[model samples]
Target: MATTASTTAPVSLASVTLEVADPEAAAVFHRAFGVDAYVGLRAAEDAPADGFRGFTLALTVSGPATVDGFVGAAVDAGATVLKPATKSMWGYGGVVRAPDGTIWKIATSAKKDTGPATREIDEFVLLLGVEDVKATKQFYVERGMAVAKSFGGKYAEFAPGTGSVKLALYKRRGLAKDLGVADDGTGAHRIVLGGTGASFTDPDGFVWEGEK
Candidate 1:
């Protein structure tokens, strides 16, 4: 008689669940750079239980913190803490509510194949919102982001170098349409400055700058 052997595949992270009141606004924030809004509402709604379709989750954290600390910070950041942070059965964990009202579970370790937890010290990406794409592209070119590609004359992508994160300039309305979300008419301008090891949004309503 022949016998069958069973095996299970390793699990991994695919995408960070960003719960925002407006998915379109979040999409605009990301598209200002070059993130493709590949998945829409139906997909996003389904991904959590599906363990993410398969991209490589990139999450943001303020810093190392215990369950209480995490919860406190989340609450103070203009967000409600839906679930009080608590230890999970799994070794590394905590949970909190994001500004957009999405529940985010904090974990110290992810499956090995999920990819690095953070960018290198000198590397980072800036996702900004822009009113006009063409003008922004010209502005970045002057600021030193070499245009790498243009998408149908609406979105412009730039890869400055390994030391700096890639950048994208996108039209807000078009970006929202492409992402299948409602556009929040914030229309804020930001100038991202590279090489400072820090990022700041200008108070003049002119620009937001991100640096190494």
Candidate 2:
């Protein structure tokens, strides 16, 4: 009998769930931050998580004013400022840690506000910090994920497909430095990704289940 290669459909991120101690509070914060629609909250009071969670949910917006708007709203919703919104060589952005311990980064490539500030999220990116970018990249590729961009062994981004969230990979230590957090964590990531394909866990231990 002849054998044929079995191929899996490309996985697209459909939803993101963050395990929090208080789902109500987390929902309120996300609502205030104007990203409630993008992220889902689940109660997990005993989920062991500390320091950096090995990932960051990034929001790409229109301009500086939008960046400031999101960061300010996040701070007012009880999030701690890790990096203030400021213009950098690349663009303007800021980092915040939600009360539930999820790190978020809001940014834009435009230094100036093109229009009035709005709570519009142009792009939602889930950046996973992995030990080996090349290995992880290959892992996803084998799973049918197409690489949208690649930079040697430093970073790799996958096509979003029909999902709302874009997925990317970065070096663990480098990602920590970018978020201004120490790259030391030991516990559940407390984050779950919903995919269009079968449930599976990535090489970095990130959980991905069928979309609900």
Candidate 3:
């Protein structure tokens, strides 16, 4: 028999969630997810803000020029470029930060995937850095996403539910050490849309926006 993920899970992300103190203001800065869930705001008492350390949202457009346009739009929206748009083995791409401070990566394939003429985000990936992949994986499991693939305690990938962006969990220190950075990510998850109802918080403090 073919296997399937659990359906009893309550949290179902409509799109990616982004918690903001002022949803109206935030609405102007970032645009990626099919849905953007919010908790309250970046300054909510329980969740404090900090430099983006743990997770990143990737937007893979269709081509190089399109990549450049997206990067430019980010900068116009108050993003600080971490890297300029350029062609490489990973195709043409660049990195930038939304005004709200979320790290955004825009890229395309190196070869034929330069993208079609229309240029649009064809793929999306959400990477969450956690203290323990197994534990975090279980947390999200309890929420909704199914474990599409995993690597012991090192990494775990969750299949996308109704949304296009796939979720993945990785060890905080492992990834930080790999990037030569310290694991200083805080609970102030500016966005955390997944699940079915009102906003909620996971064990690691990642927030999830619920259905209205």
User: Compared to the true structure, candidate 1 yields what TM-score?
Assistant: 0.35
- For TM-score, the strongest prediction is 2
Better candidate by TM-score, 1 or 2:
2
Off by more than 4 A, model 2: 1-7
| lDDT by candidate, in order shown | 0.37, 0.89, 0.65
- Count of residue pairs whose backbone atoms collide, per candidate: 9, 0, 16
RMSD of 2: 3.9
Ranking by TM-score: 2, 3, 1
Q: lDDT tens string, model 3, 1-212?
A: 11222345455555765555666666656443221432223433455777545877777777777777778777776778877887777677787766666677787885444445443567777777777788778877776567889999998987767766767777877755533345676646666555565566655666665665
lDDT of 2 by residue, 63-180 (tens): 9999999999999999999999999998999999998889999999998887999889999999999999998899888878899999999999999867688999999999999999
Provide the lDDT at 201 for model 3.
64
What's the true lDDT of residue 162 in model 3?
A: 74
Q: Candidate 3: TM-score?
A: 0.71
- What is the per-residue lDDT of model 1 for residues 72-107, given as tens digits with 9 covering 90 to 100? 544555445433443334334444434433333434
How much is the lDDT of residue 29 in candidate 2? 92
Residue 162 miss distance in model 1 (angstroms): 5.0
